[model samples]
Target: MTAERTRALQERFGNALMPTYGVPPVAIARGEGARVWDVDGRPYLDLIGGIAVSALGHGHPALVKAVADQTAALAHTSNLFLHEREVELAERLIALLGDPGARVFLANSGTEANEAALKLARKAAGPARPVLVATENGFHGRSLGALAVTGKESMRAPFGPYGTEVRFVPHGDAGALRAAVDDTVAAVIVEPVQGEAGVVPAPDGYLAAVREICDAAGAAFVLDEIQSGIGRTGHWFAHQAQGVRPDVLTLAKGLGGGLPIGACVGFGRYATAFAKGDHGSTFGGNPVAAAAALAVLDTVENEDLLGSAARTGAALAEGMRATGHPLVAGVRGTGLWLALVLTAERAAEVQARAADHGFLINAVAPDALRLAPPLTLTPEQAASFTGALPAILDEVNP
Candidate 1:
């Protein structure tokens, strides 16, 4: 939080890294629990949780031990060889899906997981079905195949010609989604909560409707739960609330805590769609990452974080709304991944001021502030930010 530490990180980042993400303002030296210290030793409560990662918080002992133990034993072995860690992690993810017959493909990141699911759906649908349906403002990933399913044109138009026939429909619009899925459709991809779009949840019945549509059309139903999975939404998978099981599911973010890992799962008949020679990833399902992910899952269950996320998240949202600050228009989304909708275009200013006050939040949209604090975030930590939010908004209100 100190000006000196912020400048130091910004300078190094501008000079050393690519211009893709631009220069970030703050530099974190280390983190423990729900708080992080800057390079200059000033502390800030990390409410963004590394864009919804860090489910067990920073430097959790279980996750650290798992990574260290697995690394000391073995790290990498391509899919050409057998590894217990990969199989074990895969089994755990499928079990979370409530489908023991499901199959899984591990990847290094969410986008790769999504890419794998896209290819699997395409292969399962055969050559005649070329159309893929995605929601407007829905974000899947940045890889070409994932990008094709993502509805943001600005990000996708620059990368075309995208190598697929993907159609965009309004998110949560049942009629549009139903009309779009046909026999020629290969898959229908949607996010349970549109995290990139300020944590906007689809209407209550939208997911179930999409599942029915995909089923009737014989198209694969894919749910991208990268940001909302692994206990972030107080559920193993966000789509579970709708009581609809997707044909394929993509997950990442908090799955491996701070480590890099992702999973693409297939259920029912779709599980056997991929042939041995059809697809693969050399570094996917490595021991270290798998162990990290397993530890995250174990800690979430052992510590009862899923319950904590729901309870703490509800209290925090209520506290913020109770502030009755002029900028506080409303709050929405689920678990710890809620968004504070602002009445004015002061979200960027609020974000900066909140950081100055030792709180790390994200201005996910011009009028919305996103909070994805660690699932282990205690009531006291939530109160800290919620208590300071009124002043933060006031300081930026002009």
Candidate 2:
């Protein structure tokens, strides 16, 4: 994109939009597969995949047709009325979860899904359990309830006086998590892989330990899979590798392809937490969104994109590691959700340079470059990123 055009759009965005996001340098015109074009027609590889929401990639044919056909047939129907799409989607989700007894509560986004999960825990535990425990640096949604349970202080402190008493422990530390889980705990919410904290995975056996501790304490075990779920991490759910199941699972991000949708799933006794009229959403399970979700689920299974993501991600991470760049410290995380650890806090510079050379990546931390490209991203595209790595690094440190 031309500097003049980028500057003009930036100025326009600053004048018209809220300051929460400030202004992005590029104005995307359109996208196809894993590539997007700027307003001025410069193409760039989309490595972030809308922060792990675009599992099928840009303008996927099945997703497009599903959304379009469903919208044309039936778009919105509040929870007051039953819709076939919603029922079918629910059944599919339960089946995919490998828990036929699991109950699903759909929402508009990840935050709302997490909010609903929090309420479920609170309701199930009653007033007797007054505390919630989460891992330090674990990023849940920004809603008041989810934010309260979230471990990041800066994201929660500005809101002041959240109703829940949340305790934090060092992530991937089983002893710390066990110490925090007492009879007074309502729930222990954690992300299997810490997304915003530079793609940090839970230490092997850590999640299973938390599951055991929470079981002993009768605390709800809630896994917020908002970023790592829906085939991004080579599994339907990242915690599956631990061979344990969470009592409550919050999902979103890639649930509806590009459409906005989320779900809070409760299993076994936790399924009965919300009573009649206990909780609800007006547009949570819209027919169109459900249809889109069904399509995404179908595509993942039929096309075997999960295997592709796992194989491609492993190769990409290995190639990056072999590069031996001075900035490269190590590769952490798993499957498609991996990060390049840097010896110096120059992630922003690296990301900016990569984007300038037609690749979009996220600087998740001061020293970590996160990669969550679409599950459908080809191995060739992964190689392309590794091929361009040296120049990207040189441009940053030269």
Candidate 3:
């Protein structure tokens, strides 16, 4: 069944879809917890967790019920008429962050949430202060507004004439950030953890330094936690661990579990920047999406998945480190968010071999393999992967 589906999909959709992603042709039919069975009846432990989007895993009962109930009752009512779910979700998110008075603008993806954050920062800065500073190797999104601030030259080079006057500063360099962001700057956008940059975390005191600089310059501090938030890092929001609060925070990826949802949260003074018609989205806060996000939150809290992620992740990291596998240079990151740096250019081979061993991982870069399994992953599952790691590394290296 899987092979047939794969063949049919490739034949009918050959090159029709964008070529951004390579072809693997795994026909996934259903998923539960941390395991997914391909159409061919092959079960694989999902470690990427849909690129860190499936916080509650696939087809979770709570999430399914939330979507079903909300869609039947009120799927969408447009932005003109307010719905209860949007308000409820916003309140829940703000409360989760421990910031009650924060205001939220909903969107459908991390990039869109970031787009809204960029707009809010620009609006708050006025015409005189139009410059935005972003960290190198940081990724915001692909939209023109978000793309302008993304620091990857490879991605930005193709999209010339970007809309914003953005400056790129070195990640984890507070002195450079302070120098770049001044009174003339509108905002300094940063990622608490550089997810796409192979799970590079900000240096100690870096976020706080950025906060201080932004405050001194009267610029908005926008923290992009799209991939690091929602308990991926064992924290409701990664920035919370750093004891720094940003003027604006963007969230998505894992927010809706497997469903699509994004939010731009503004705090205190930044909250009031978007008044009346400043910005809007047609399906930003649709009831179904909000319900899904709520379900994800509920599952994380009720099941104590945050604590699980921390414990399991620590164990996995320790085991990987113990291997002393020459190919494995080191392990970095916290909670379920981790990356293994390889000494050679065999990360892709390791990923493919791991798949053959019924484990799915991501070779995010040539020398980096990223792992963000479902928060509900069991100790047995973690052991299974770590136990197989030495052999996988041997296969790749030998």
Best by lDDT: 1
lDDT of 1 by residue, 43-122 (tens): 99999999999898999999999999999999888888988989899888877777789999999999999999999998
Model 2 C-alpha lDDT per residue in residues 1-398, reported as the tens digit of each score: 35767778888889999998767867888999998998878898898989999989999999999999999999998989989998898898898889998999999999999999989999999999989998899899887888887788888899969977889999989898888889999999999989999999877888888889999999999999999898888888888867899999999998888899999999988887799899999999998989999989999988998898899999989989988989899999778888999989999999989988999999999999999888889999999999999889988875
Question: What lDDT is reached at residue 11 by model 2?
Answer: 88
Q: What is the C-alpha RMSD, rounded to one decimal, of candidate 1? A: 1.1
lDDT of each: 0.90, 0.90, 0.90
Q: What is the lDDT of candidate 3?
A: 0.90
Sequence-dependent TM-score of model 1: 0.98
Q: Model 3: which ten-residue window has the lowest total lDDT? A: 1-10
Per-candidate TM equals: 0.98, 0.98, 0.97
Candidate 2: regions farther than 4 A off: none
TM-score computed on alpha carbons, candidate 2: 0.98
